[model samples]
Target chain A: MSTAGESGKGVGGLSTAKRRPGRRPGSADTRGEIIIAARKIFSEKGFDKATIRGIAREAGVDPALVHHYFDTKDGIFVAALQLPVEPAKVVPLILAGPREEVGERLVRFVLTMTADPEAREPVIALMRSAMTNEQVVVMIREFLTAAVLNRVVEALGIPPVNMEVAFAQVFGVILMRYVLRLEPLASIEVEELVQIVAPTIQRYLGGD
Target chain B: MSTAGESGKGVGGLSTAKRRPGRRPGSADTRGEIIIAARKIFSEKGFDKATIRGIAREAGVDPALVHHYFDTKDGIFVAALQLPVEPAKVVPLILAGPREEVGERLVRFVLTMTADPEAREPVIALMRSAMTNEQVVVMIREFLTAAVLNRVVEALGIPPVNMEVAFAQVFGVILMRYVLRLEPLASIEVEELVQIVAPTIQRYLGGD
Candidate 1:
């Protein structure tokens, strides 16, 4: 993966279409090829202008093969971004914790995901794409609202409305500190950032 | 101005050619026209896509007219947004009152600007545009950092680093209540909202 450079071809000795020999029998290499191509295409052209056919051409696969793997452009997008961790899985982690601990967990989860060198690029790409592309923005917002925010609200036994507010506060902090990289906040240690922000998020989530 | 609507011209009634009377002789109407055109263009296209030529076309003026009035696209944007009231105007207002009142004033200023029906559209547009547009985002971040956050920190006499965390809290509240319009926060009366939120803002700005 690191060997793949600006030309979209893998560096010395790596075959672009080579799949691991012992992988699941039915899974085609085309799907992985399409996703890699899509990531490069989406990053270069953004979500709106990048076409499915273009991705197929870049991947050296038929457009039908691309569709076979993913249901829609959005499906391809989700796959390409490699957002393998579903919000469903993570949202429950925050909710299962005590109400006071939920904020801490939420902050920690975001920080941990973004802090990883490998994970950071895709997340930043997703955010940048979301900012520019209305469809991507809507998709991301729906994912956040449903899989993350709604679950947290339900778990806390709070009204949906209040829960959304709390989610906004939590997400806003994550955006500011991680995505936007606003000064001092960006540079601060994770523990201090979580400590200062968690209490406010906790209050929004469950306080009077 | 009211009759202009009946005449079927879009906002501000003056024809694309006929200069409005109130504006100064040569430069003022051109400047106003450029700004009005710039706002529409920027809102429709976002910052990166919006061009001076597009603005001039929208204004039905020569491109040179735009350069003559504003020099650069950013200058035009700054003028169009009419964010002339910088932190200098705001910081003193927040600081001049009792320390306890700072939160109320901060909330009031943000809410008042956002709540104004006429102002809301452009302000929200600026925010949305800022999310994707690097130049515009930089300008906004700079203003938020230098003018807004810096003033609050100086007034409170806190270490500069702490201000970013404080700002994240304050901005999160505002973004939720105002921009995202999340539930209970959205429905709450301004006074009640202020009461609930001001303490938090106060704490972030100056409290322990």
Candidate 2:
């Protein structure tokens, strides 16, 4: 997060040396920096109040570069929140298998997502933060609705509440396993978790 | 918690006026003071390290009164952590009905426990604290195993891991509905949640 733009205030941000103007589009660290900056701005102003311009200023990059990387405000927000996988990408992965296997697939997928400590940290951190921050809850609720849960609900054509419950069950498992590190759940193999959880998840999704 | 005994540094605790040797057995507020003191000591010294004598000292009471009130250290821990229902109390309730209906009863009971803002606060606070503190998580896990989950596991004859998974499902619901307030899970009717969740919970318990 560049304090330079924040201190100077409004538009003409940071040094001329730092402004790349979409030149380093392939830069990974720059993408990471933008996400870090976006996280701060979103936490401070919330989703609706935050803008591409503000996030760009905070990242010490031009607004055009933000658009070039993320394409839209929601994209930036998703990046900021650090979801385990791309929302656009995860839907197809979840839906590609047989309808009856959706629950197992989902359990497997989520367990896989959290298996990597680096990937799991932000997701766990989001849930952890949401416990204390209402603003974080609102941000998470909005993101879950717009990016992840709603699409799955639409694809499955189930009641939204039912999907939320299904999500809750799986989400709880993640909490127990990853955050709480509740034993046996934490150490239990992925295949075992899928067996124990998939049927219930399937039942919630309107399958047997 | 009484700071008087905590600072005085020995067995000679509090004033003669305050130390009633098992005298107000029915006094509700004193019991509350003891629990509050236990929470502080448990947080400070951890579960194993915390002693009934120390807790009594902190509450400015006789150690005999602590035993009279709680029967054992584990009982005192349960009271301190504030499980929504008693561990000794809740298992009978969860197991009293038809096995098929166990999930319904469990979900309904948990939801009811959290429905009251007063009762819900400590449970939610424990979870919130557990997210940040490893000591709190250890205390919670030990308490859950001894007080709640193991009894149910033995009652139903399911594997311990299976029971933990069932708990993860319900724990997740409590988190989503109460802590995170993830709607419509947060706003949905209790009966509806029971309907959505019972079957999954039932499955985890080796029912149906």
Candidate 3:
């Protein structure tokens, strides 16, 4: 009899899949398992060395099963981070506020997301990976350019010529404080930091 | 009998003792050769994978010669980059100006250093290497803290508690614009960008 747990098994005997069969059993569950495994393996070994087979083994699925969920290693990586969070979810909220207030919202969102202990590790991992892994770096660069910075440019209605430089200024501030953990910026209260930084971001995003 | 370029041949030979004919015959020349080789190898293989033997081979000197010049891989790295220009050299210049003017000077220094096409590659390589190598990262963080931001804190006469956060904000802005290559920032004129960002950095560094 295939019990809820048994249904999770694959090429490996007695799969280590964390989900019970009670959860929907299609793409979603399989995808989730791959993500959890990838995150673990990527964190342990880093991007260059972590293999697909290792992720598959950890997830308790066949190598093919892992591929079925994610078409390639990069695909698995993007899925693992739950990244490329749709701008649609964030852009409207930022735009809904007054033009001057956009910087505050943007700063708050980034700080809140990165400040969470649970969320911090994945971001740090992704950044570390992006430095070493060419494909991942390209993907991250593209996503940052297209989804996050582009939307800010659009929302602010800045000239296309100015968009790139402005976004660089805003993103640079976040990267230094959040990823590099530079002093003063890292230790400051978020509200205080935001109050000081937001206006510059707003000016960059909105225009002179 | 010894000439500068001919002595370079000794630098290219793989045997350490053979390469050293006269008193300190090839020491300075050998060190220079090693640095050139190391820069090429490091740029190609990056910091993590580039080996001492590979650098020795490229320099045409024995591995011992490479070690003689630099005690460890990091010693070679720091020497190769010639990055001993710490905050002590740069920071006081930043603080020397009026408080309101400090941000512009700080941003100008970073942007100017990075914007130069010749200097840009090494800075980028340093950033990428620091992300992957913990030792290098710690060295960089400490240097930036002690030499740059801490001085700013002292100059401003703020409590030590406040220095870290202030540094974070200022460095954050610099990193985003320079390292990440964010839009508008990467594209914008340095002077324009400096004008816009300086006040905020000034505020974070010392402004009320």
**Which candidate gets the maximum TM-score versus the true structure?**
2
Global lDDT of each model?
0.63, 0.76, 0.62
Candidate 3 lDDT, tens digit per residue, B1-208? 1112232354445554434433233553677778898878766675666788999888877887677657567667666776533444466776786776766787788777767665666666667777776556655565456546568777788765345544444444445555554555557787877776566566556557
- Which residue pairs overlap in candidate 2's backbone? none
Could you tell me the lDDT of residue B52 within candidate 1?
A: 87
In what order do the candidates fall by TM-score, top score first?
2, 1, 3
Worst 10 residues of 1 chain A by lDDT: A1-10
Better of 2 and 3 by DockQ: 2
- TM-score, per-candidate, Cα-based: 0.62, 0.81, 0.60
> Which residue segments of model 3 deviate by more than 4 Å?
A1-80, A159-179, A206-208, B1-81, B158-180, B206-208
Best by lDDT: 2
Clash count for each candidate, listed in order shown: 0, 0, 18
lDDT of 1 at B73: 66
Docking quality tier of model 3: incorrect
TM-score of 3: 0.60
- lDDT tens string, model 1, A95-173? 7767667767877777677667566667656655664565565455554555566677777777665565555555666
- Give the residue spans of candidate 1 off by over 4 A: A1-81, A117-134, A178-180, A206-208, B1-26, B29-80, B173-192
